[model samples]
Target: MPLNKKLAEKLNKRFAPDSRLDDTYQGLDLTYITNELGEPITLFIGKRRPDGAITGERYVRTIKRVPNSDQIASSHWDLKGKVSRS
Candidate 1:
């Protein structure tokens, strides 16, 4: 399922300073989904077409909350080995 309104907005603001979303991915067409445990995961990242459809690279990163804070942060989120579309 897609992220909820509040959560989506929070994530967008948190990831706003991410340069990789532009320099590396070439665009900010990212989608965030949470797992059963409510942990945010970045499932897709790519470019958004004129029609507002996102199409591109897929990722699998389990985001975690920062120690002593409510803020979530990713560590070594860079794409690594084969990431199957599944």
Candidate 2:
């Protein structure tokens, strides 16, 4: 399923305060945060880990960010996706 507009908007507001995503764009498997001039800032990718005690698994990722732009780029391994700002 695609991400709801309201939820996406909220995330965009939280992550990319200076810019807004297009309404037509659906759920994002990956998201990148770029500077106003379109420079890469950070990279985040998702991962899944097995939990022996739990019925299901947990998802997480290691994020890398650049101090200069304070932006972020994220990818989802489970979803097999990647997003880059520049």
Candidate 3:
């Protein structure tokens, strides 16, 4: 996937190598899919195990752009599949 340059710049501060936007955690890795306009639309969240295996969770994270601005007013994360405890 191509990098979202505009969003990345806003997500990190000068001199900061890390992204302010949430991506990964102790055992989970996240990948994103963007639209033609370079906006993130889909997310693939994977959970890593000690046995070198991974489990995945698909989600939709929609960004609401602020009217007449380059800023995102808000965003929402919604799980894609049926909800259940494993």
* Highest lDDT against the true fold, candidate: 3
Model 3 TM-score (2 dp): 0.47
Clashes of each: 0, 2, 0
For residues 38-77, write the lDDT of model 3, one tens digit per residue: 5556655576445433357666766788899857788666
Q: What's the ranking of the predictions by TM-score, best on top?
A: 3, 1, 2
Best by TM-score: 3
* Ten residues in sequence with the least summed lDDT for candidate 2: 48-57
What is each predicted model's overall lDDT from 0 to 1? 0.46, 0.33, 0.52
Candidate 3 colliding pairs: none
Ranking by lDDT: 3, 1, 2
State the lDDT of candidate 2 residue by residue for 1-86, as single tens digits. 33344633433333443342222123323333444544322223222123212112122323345666555564221222433332
Off by over 4 Å in 1: 1-27, 50-53, 62-86
The true-versus-predicted C-alpha distance at residue 43 of model 3, in Å, is 1.3
Displacement of residue 11 (Cα, Å) in model 1 is 6.7
Spell out the clash pairs found in candidate 2.
Answer: 33-72, 42-73
Check candidate 1 and list the clashing pairs: none
**TM-score of each candidate structure, all chains considered together:** 0.35, 0.22, 0.47
Tell me how far the alpha carbon of residue 44 in candidate 3 is from the true structure, in angstroms, after superposition: 0.7
